[model samples]
Target: MGGPSREMTVMRIPLKKAKHHFGASLSRGTRPYNEDAYQAGTIDIPAFAKRRPISLTRNPKGEIKNEVTPAGSSSGDPQVFYFGVFDGHGGNECSGFLMEELHKYIEDAAKDFELESSLQIKGPVHRYIGWSGSAEVDEQMPASGSAPETTAEESLGAVKTYTPSGTESMKPPKPGSKHDGPTPGAKSRQSPLSSAPPVKQSMSVRKAEDLERELVMDWKELVGGYFRRFKPEWFSMSAGGRGHPAEQDVIAKRHYPNSAVPNEAVEGIGIETVLQYAFLRADYDFVSAQVGKRDEDPVLADRAINDDDILGHPSRGGKSIGGTKRFKGGSTCSMALVSTPTPTPFWHPAAPSTVVTAHVGDTRIILCKTATGLAVPLTSNHHPSLPEEATRLRRYAATFVTDSFGEERVSGLANTRAFGDMQSKRIGVSAEAEIRRIEVTSAEYSFMTLVSDGVSGHLSDQEIVDIIKEAQTPEQAARDVTSFATEVSADADNATTLVVRLGGWERRTEGGLGSLGTKELRDWRKAEAENPRGRM
Candidate 1:
């Protein structure tokens, strides 16, 4: 905020018997508070010998059984590389929360694959989990009760409609119109603290709260059950069931139906679904905590409630007054997951890695091709101006307006999709992520870049790629890109950059801005020389 606040992180990831380098840099640029957050690391999945099991096997009696033993530790745990960047608005709390909890949820969601076996049969399962009909099954399942569940959006009628051309604002619903809320027999979205049964709406209508509850219950049952299976002492020692009273009650009263022995197999959902699940779960937890709902899980509790740096009510000058967490803040999230290639029948040893990109809001990821320094965009920004995003926001009759700076804003938010903007939830502001997958050959791509809007807004994709290619290391690449953003933008926002070096990093062909002696390149070099270590 004052002098630039800069932070750097470097990670060494093992990929196909080789060490890969990745790093991140964050710089507070002209902002009173730096709300951007990012993370990079690895997630270990149990390695199965031949095939990875998604669901538990069933016996003749149709009762679920855990066949794997606790001591059955397998070899070759597959590690997934994870990189995420979050940009916060209104406050830093939301981004900060994501920095700590998003990856944990992703790891938990990944476990849904080998839920039972993952616990007992430890080690990385070599196979990538392909799409199964689990989502279809969940979609087809009837709502928990006779009546359908209601979402907050339903309670508040559409007051406006946003379109690619412009926004059309509508008058408030007529005094006695259908905008009043859910009809009789319809269940309302409940707070995690509420004793009311969670609203089980259709997938199309399900809110973040619903998914958050499902995640918590699933963890309590699946993981807690794992501890319970071994020993009573171990369960207690593991603190398997510690949490809010309401959560504990829910856990005690119900269990994951999937945990029950099934007559047929239930395959785990694909990685795309896992990413979506994690994004929603993390968003829900953040929103719920803002309203004072806290979980006992150490990781969840630490970020949700214990961080003193978390922003409080905006009305209270954005600082926690009297040690109480307050008000709604929002964060945009972009993440990339790199998993080992699922082997083909022929078993090609040099298969490309599968890269999954999932995100909401304006942050994005770009892949730099080694052949010609090509910038390939993996994630698209979700702004109301986009046709698809505009159509989605229109369902809630959301309004779009141009700010004084000439940027389009949905309702009052810059992003149509984001995490933790609780106030805008009713108007169809969403945390639902856009998921994409690609196979990257180490010979074709040099690296991947993940950046918050601050950097992307100031630098073109090719320019970013060229800057990273010009750097000596991932850390320097991150710093150079972010520092360059500040140099170009008069009022640069908090800029954050992450660079992931791939196998082709050393074998790149010069092209685009990287090969040109452009004025931009000269200006960047001049700025770098003058302030080699300015702020960041």
Candidate 2:
């Protein structure tokens, strides 16, 4: 591939025709630690208030139509389905935390966008990030090879806020499950300290570590408080300004993938600002939660522009109720939010009215057009080797060094941007995400592939498309893609994949509660997807 002849030959090969499939798979590649994570579900507009669908009469005097209505819950107002993949790096902490909170938080933020469409109200900007682990500890936690990757639900307990009270619980991918974790490989990560700092920790490093714990707790409380209940401060940034110019044509093209309204009647709201707000907050929290009051970091200036006061007063508990411990870990994430003007549909809840693609780090969100099988990438990688990202690293004075593995890392990290690398953020490794507007037109659209770098780093997008085309079903495509990478990729780290299809959600009208949709698909990759170890 080095010479002009090789390069020309590579380009000469025709791109494979894209195909549409309905299967989904997740594979943990040849890594000791399977840090990759994913979540797919429906997000409904949270009601400003709670009301039981059917309430019993208290003394029957105030009848008021409170009789036997066969209590059924509302599907959700302006419902949208979400699919996300978190590629944890330093550790799984950040990914675990994000899997739990990111979608719910974005749901809360969308209220502002919904209001913008109407000429009536003014609102404030609300921002927060759900990062796991404490920044004070620079050491990676002990690897849990035998343990299953924890669900955000189990990790955070029951997050009672906006989640539907009676909706069935989402199950964690079971052990021995196909789409669970890493492929059955023993390539566990060696000690991260292999790239040690020094015989003795520097006074500066010690000082930063001690201070970071308290600072991280501040943002944790701020984010946790937002989930407890709503306050005026959450909407302080709502006073509207014409947000970044969105693709004007996006609104007109997308038919209501999941929405109750038609495309012609839709209005493009100011959601871009909301996306930026979420990205900035995740990075802001990461940096501020790590550095001292005196560190002369450039991001500090952007901090002033964002303002910490936006969080209102920091609560006194100084602890997250989620009971999620602070660990020294980082994770890369790609989340897709399909916002539409639907009042919320009944039978077709998971339809694709694609609106926004949000991301950070190398996890990629790729759009595959089913009509022509054209592959459209929605995100660009944020890695140190990338020219622009490396420039930002140099500007921030990141101590770049080649690790024992001959891979360039920022203070021993493989990637440049993430949710919870307090250590990296101190040296200006930010978590600011790049948000893009994508209008999903049903006619030209197909399923989307959201994956961690383990897959992208090894196989090209075209190759993945080829696999999709060759496989019989979407699930098989996921399996083939994951199996190929684990068996063949150069690094074979944790490979997690989510194949999202518009209009794929179908709820059973007869199931009482907590029942799975019609698709009885099996998961190919698993956290414990590794080979069974022999007894000593």
Candidate 3:
């Protein structure tokens, strides 16, 4: 019996890949620290007005679930840009599904409107068919696909009654009478009545108008039902470990009518819906570029370039020292789509198009107004330090560790909010996404860096800003910042960086090697050098 039991136990052990508990890794606590630096070389170049552009990079720590979608339309009729970043936790199913379906839904809605409009202009054939006593029959057709046929009396009630005998006397003309017979050899006369002054057909005109109105109303109702049916498939939530239909209802209630929904819940549906409509109303275009060893390899670089070579060749960075891979995920995804229906009448030409970024466990949307040098942060970071996060942490009995950067726990994995890691959510560590709106002005345009916590974990925000200040181009700044982080946390896991710089405008070009004058710049540089790898 004991031998059989042992064999059964061995057989019952589950395979690692097949396990569903997303929390298994988290429950095991942090991985053993491995100190190795990954170094990639850097580029030295002068800043140019036209040379600046956005840059991105990513590295796999282990397994990651991040997806990004960027689209733009610049038809000159209405210019619009859209960008979205979805960071999935638990699994990639939700984010991946959303990336493909959201855009299609928007496009489908637009096409439905166009088709409805075209159907409104019914020509003469439509008028004749509609007038041939067919409308009454259609009205009695039991609402097309509805079940349960109507009774004969009910169907007949829908048709209008016309009694000829009561309305006008029917006088049968006598055989060979003058009214019925052709006059004997009288000059064949054309009836003056044939060209009688054109009688204005008000009834026909009114029918056409009614048809158009009905077509519009039907289209609206159909689209509304479609949205109601499909929106719930996008998300799922449970309460107290029990099945709750109300949760589905809550998400369904959030769907906007022909509008884009923001990540935030309090902002309500109207504002985001209207903003999305305006932004998507115009046409724009998008192109995604990557910078990393995998992308820059000779064979891979060839296919990444275009005829116009709008995206230059992939550039290499420092070497990867073994063990420096901070986050075990895929590369960061960044995209820029054009924003049409420009907010201003003056036409702000230098905006960053539309920027969307997603880290392995977070979602962020950023809009860059290059003309005004403003970086509007349309979403918030899912950090664990917020009040809501603190409450969640207490529920999980999770401890917090204070570092120079701020207060983080478990080497920052314990952030109150994150994208992936369903295991975390099981412990009440739910992610609360924040959406921020900041104006990016020229003064703030030095360069922008959007990175995963793998990099941010080790470096302070000011430290990153200083790196941008030191580098000549945005790409160089990204590399330098990444390099510094790797070096400092040579013992850390996967680290990644994405940098965006404003182009198409002129700025000061004087300080190359000696421009570390400002107090903010000096402080930032000092902080960066002191903690290059972000280790506290």
Index of the highest-lDDT prediction:
1
**Tens digits of lDDT, candidate 1, 1-536:** 44322122222323222323666788889888899998776655432222222222322211112211111123233345668899988878788778877888877765543222211222222111111232333432323433322222331221111122331222223445676221100011111111111111111112322443455454334333221222111011122212211233334334556543222121122444456667756765666556563223556445543344435532433233112445466989888776542211101122245566777888878877655555677776677767777776665467789999776886678788888776776566767777665654424567788998888875656667767877887778888888887676667799999988765665433433342423344354346446746335
Model 3 alpha-carbon drift over 4 Å, by segment: 1-381, 392-413, 428-432, 438-446, 503-505, 508-536
Instruction: Judging by lDDT, tell me the better candidate of 1 and 3.
Output: 1
lDDT of 2 at 274: 47
What is the C-alpha lDDT profile of model 2 across 365-476, one tens digit per residue?
A: 7654443343457777775666766876676456678878666677777677778766554565555566665543222344567777777775555445445544555566
| Predicted candidate 3 versus true structure: per-residue lDDT over 1-536, tens digit per residue | 32332212211112122221000010101324311111111111110011111112321111011211112122222222233433332233333433433344334423322211111123332221122232322422222232332232332233222222322221323546565222110111111111101101112222322332443243234333211121111012211111111233334545757433222221111111111221221100000001111323454435433433434743343222111122222111222222211211111223222222222222222222222322233333334554544654555456667777564653345344432222333333322222222222222233344543444545544344445555655556556655665555434434445444432112312222212323343344345457747344
What local distance difference test score does each model get? 0.53, 0.45, 0.29
Residue 140 CA error for candidate 3 (Å)?
48
* Candidate 2: Cα lDDT at 24: 49
Backbone clash count, each prediction separately: 12, 34, 56
Candidate 1 ranges beyond 4 A from true positions: 1-20, 46-75, 113-268, 293-323, 342-351, 509-514, 517-536
Task: Please give each candidate's TM-score.
Answer: 0.58, 0.50, 0.35
